[model samples]
Target chain A: MRSEELIGELTAGLRPVRRMASPARQAGLWLGLAALAVGLAVLANGLRHDLQERMLMPQEVGQWLASVLAGVLAAVAAAMLARPDRSWRWVLLPVPALIGWFGSLGWGCLADLARLGPMAGQIGTSWGCLRFILAMGVPLAAVLFWLLRHAGPVRPMPVLLLGGLASAALCSAGLSLFHHLDAAVMVLLWHGGAMLLLVLAGALLGRPLVMRRQA
Target chain B: MSRTEGEWEAWMAAAQAGDAAAYDRLLRAALPLLRAVARRRIVNPAEAEDAVQDALLTIHTLRHSYEPARPIRPWMVAICERRAIDRLRRQGRRGGRETPIDDFGETLAAPGANKGEERVAAAELRAAVAELSEPQRTALRLAKLEDLPLTEASARSGMSVGALKVATHRAMKVLRRRLGVEE
Candidate 1:
């Protein structure tokens, strides 16, 4: 259609629209819902027996805090990406927290390797962790996508990449609360692997899933 | 009249409030800016126009995302740029698989062999099929002539799907050889 004609049609169809809340506000709402979901999942799965002792260690505390922070920042980043005027730099919001997350895991891995030698690298198949993360992460991703779908994000791939990461990070943190695995290598392999899978799934499916709403 | 940045912002704010006149003015005034932004990414004039339309549609859908307090130009420009790039990518994907009508100098001839030649070919195919073994003939009839799926063909012919497939393959090969067609 001609630009002038489109203007006429759009104006004719115009309706009052309540402006969306700010990105930070949206992120907060998403995080609140996500926390509730995680809380329910933890309740069903039951908390780890060593949860109290693990909280006492500084390294464990750092990892937990970093994971939660990364999830929070990633959710904010994904929300910011929905705003057309928002700079691409919003994608970097979770980087510092992610570095901290990986750093804590690396430190733990080193400690395990020093203590257990080759036994530290003995990674077993944790189908339960995979199932847990997917169960929690997929719903969280669906909710995030629903929340941001109205924005018709211009950068859907990056938005979904961050959004998927946010969901996975939060779910992994929740997993730590219920499923006990002391070795960081095990956590990195199983939980980190699941997170990678989710991120890739989001990026691959971004154009089709998000662009459907866009069109 | 060309609108100032603040005016554009005000107009968009009004647009969100269902002010039709303000929305029309805002969209019309933004056309040239959107055009310029689209042209930066899309070299073809028609494609650039398409990008502009796409950007406008996106703007309409996401009107609520436009914060009244923020400058509108960047928001508008970003939408135009992204839409243009999206159009270019789509065009690139299509270019590989499609031949444009303009690429041809003249209209192509009518489809297929002439009527007489087609009839002769059909008769020869029928004769060849008649000469095939019973299993091959049934395979050709059920699977090829009827265009039934392998499973259905197998069920009708009382042969396994794998056997149906093999028979069909052999039948086609024999027919091709009998008709002196190339592999």
Candidate 2:
């Protein structure tokens, strides 16, 4: 089509549109809504019996903070990436937090190994963690995807990857609040694996999930 | 032309509010800049024009992503760059699979059919190339004008393959800019 004709068609079709909220603001909204949903899920499942004591432990605190930070940062990154002008470095926002999360998990695993010899990293039947992540993570992811869908991310892979990470990380953090599994290796394997799976799922669904709806 | 402070930003803000005149003004003003950026990567005029149109359409659809408070040029440039890259990739893929239906053999057999035009273009290119830096000139001569392999170019130029590639890329940019195809 000729440039003039296209410009005419576009200008003729113009309609008022609500500007997309800033990435930080949208992420904040997602964080708030996600926190509320996860909190409700935790409440329904009931908090861990030793929640107060676990909160006092350095490793436990570190793990919780790391999970929360990773989730929040990933959500922010996902939101930021919806804009074409945003730097790719925004996608790396969650790296430090993820490192902290892994460090905490490794520290716990090492402590267990020192204490329980070969029995420390036992793989148990904790399918509940997987179930929890899917149950809670899916809805959180759906909400995030819905929020970002309108913006139509230029490169959807990283946005979806970060969104998935945000959802899973938040769910895992919530899981620690309620679920009473003390096996670091089990939590790392199950929880971390669940997060990885969610991220992969999001990435695979990238193009479809964030594509702008055709008129 | 000089613009008033935040003129484009104000126009974009108005465009979001469904002001067609403001939107038209913004699009018209942005067209040349978008075209220039597209032409930087897409040498073919038709493909570059398509890239520019694609970018404008993208800007229309994703207008809501524009923040009125921010500078508009970077956002527009990024979209244009993405469209240009997409066109280049599409061209590359199609180039590998498709052949031209119109064979040039008959045309080439005709005496001096396009010779005058070709000479004019070649002279223009040479003039532009002569203004390039020494490294850039050599890189263009070896890698592009002579169509030599990078290894051969590197061997002849005493520059690393990586350096030769950079020099060639910079040379192309200079040539494009000098030829008034790109900014």
Best by lDDT: 1
Q: DockQ numbers for every candidate? A: 0.45, 0.41
Q: Could you tell me the lDDT of residue A39 within candidate 2?
A: 95
Specify the poorest-scoring 10-residue window by lDDT in model 2 chain A: A206-215
lDDT of each: 0.87, 0.86
Expressed as tens digits, the lDDT of each residue in A107-175 for candidate 1 is 888888888787535567788888888878987887787777754448777788899999999999999
TM-scores for every candidate against the unseen true structure: 0.74, 0.77
lDDT of 2 by residue, A62-109 (tens): 889999999999999999887788888998899999999998898888
- Write down the worst ten-residue block by lDDT for model 1 chain A: A206-215
Highest DockQ: which candidate? 1
lDDT of 1 at B147: 96
